[model samples]
Target: MASVQKISTCLWFDTEALEAAQFYTAIFKKASIGRITRYGKEGFEYHQKPEGSVMTVEFTLDGTPFLALNGGSIFKFSEAISFIIHCSDQDEVDYFWEKLTEEGDPAAQQCGWLKDKYGVSWQVIPVEMVDLLNDPDNEKSQKVMAAMLPMKKIDLATLKEVYVRG
Candidate 1:
């Protein structure tokens, strides 16, 4: 039996709820689309969306449940919130960086952070980064921070090299 999640993150989109859910599921392992809800006639007066249009899409990404809502253009995505992908190695980091940035804005790329085609922000970071940044040696941590500050897509190999050199 599947256990229920007490909380789930919700993503707001301007009529791309279903598409975004599908796209996210395709990218993450162990992910799948679940229930889909459409706007009903009862809420037409307030929502103003087409009654039959998608209202929400439930999905799981790497086992974490999420909801995508077609909430109209009144709200827009901002840099304040972002999903972080904790990559295990260079391969994982490279894979996410390439896939997520395929149709994304190149101008928005900075310090391992990117905005996808859907305008959703993501941070592709190596799991080892935490340890490197938390090192007891301040100089070592500073070196790692310097190497990371100028990178768009995180280079795990380069980070590792800097850590060793320090």
Candidate 2:
């Protein structure tokens, strides 16, 4: 028999995992709720708390697996790790930048990085960025990077201007 295969990305939240999951499902398409397992007697005994609390909640966003729990609100998501989104052109980059930054913190770069309202980090990068950065002249790439270091959504026009000036 062939084993079932599933790809998932786990997120750690400070007691807001469930709420974040709900928010993501609502914002994206092809999303829905899945299995929800409550805390059992064993867990309660171990944690010394009441039963029926959220032990785990599974859900799918755009067909992606996500698990949420009622873990105490202590830790939070930060910029140490982020999801990178590759875009085909400026339009795609702009669109994703607009949507992802709606309730997130924007960073300064040609490749975008933001922390969402739920504290999840994301990197929205244009597909052509590699070509621009891989120019034979390192000066061009350096200039582009420098110019992009202060922008939130990354203006492609500015990056191109920097590249041409080199």
Candidate 3:
């Protein structure tokens, strides 16, 4: 029997579906490409893409199922939607920030959010930040929020320092 994924996110790309899948799988642990579907002749009238070109790339990143579609350039990614990576510590945050932003636009980076080379937005944040932000003490949350606003990549230590000092 063929099992079905309960839900999966489909990422739209102009033609970097395969490339983006490979890039994401390489960066994340327990990630790998699953299947590659190419366009067929029958769809030429609508899709307009050459037959045999990549249509979709199915992949998993850290157990999260995703599909990268080589749709045309009619749409682009925006900061309105972003995937958040909760890191256990500073090192994890740094690693993801460095890798995701390696070829990404520096100007688009702000408040721990960055648009990767493929134009996908991601938020690399420390796991501790969640707890701090949700802390019942409004002062602590405000302090952490203040500390986080001015940074591109999150600084776990600095956030902790602010939370503790407050």
Candidate 4:
């Protein structure tokens, strides 16, 4: 059989997989929910749920593949791996920063790292950040990094000011 071209990311939710998927799909464009299969009696788990309950809930976020599973709530999203959004300008950064940062969860870090409401990490970086970081002057780049360290979504103008000072 020919290999199918498909990509998927599995998300473990504490019995909130479907709700989370719906919330996410509604926020993003070109995204929608997929099939949600419930558990059957034969495969059901004794303690909580059936064996097949929410085996997989496939969906997309801005064309990116994703799957939400109704798994235990032992683990939640953290600051380890984050989504990097290459923003063209401040408006784009503000847009994503405002939307993803609902629910009063907003923390800023250096170099464009932020924690959203769902505890999911995000990086709203300006496209110019690459060039700034790659500057030949180590001191200049370091200075810019220092300024960025305390920021949530990077401000291009502020970064430029720091870069010029170096």
User: Largest lDDT belongs to which candidate?
Assistant: 3
Candidate 2 Cα errors over 4 Å, as ranges? 1-7, 26-33, 47-53, 59-64, 106-111
Instruction: Find the number of clashing residue pairs for candidate 1.
Output: 0
Instruction: TM-score for candidate 4, please give it.
Output: 0.80
TM-score, ranked from best to worst: 3, 1, 4, 2
* Cα lDDT, model 2, residue 35: 76
lDDT of 3 at 32: 94
Model 1 over residues 1-166: C-alpha lDDT tens digits?
8877998899999999999998888888889999999998997888999888999999999888999999999898988999999999889999989889989989889888999999999999889987898999999999999999999998878887999999
- Which sections of candidate 4 miss by over 4 Å? 1-7, 50-55, 107-111
The positional error of residue 139 in candidate 1, measured at the CA in angstroms, is 0.7
Model 3 segments more than 4 A misplaced: none
lDDT per residue for candidate 2 within 26-92, as digits (tens), equals: 7555789777777678866555545876666777766567787666665666678777767778887
Q: What is the per-residue lDDT of model 3 for residues 68-143, given as tens digits with 9 covering 90 to 100?
A: 9999999999888899998999999999999999899999998899999988899998888889988999999999
**Between the candidate structures 3 and 4, which one is better when assessed by lDDT?**
3
For model 4, the run of ten residues with the poorest summed lDDT: 103-112
Best by TM-score: 3
Better of 2 and 3 by TM-score: 3
Which digits, one per residue and each the tens of the lDDT, describe model 4 over residues 81-158?
Answer: 787878788888887777777773644444567676556677777888778988999999988888877776678899
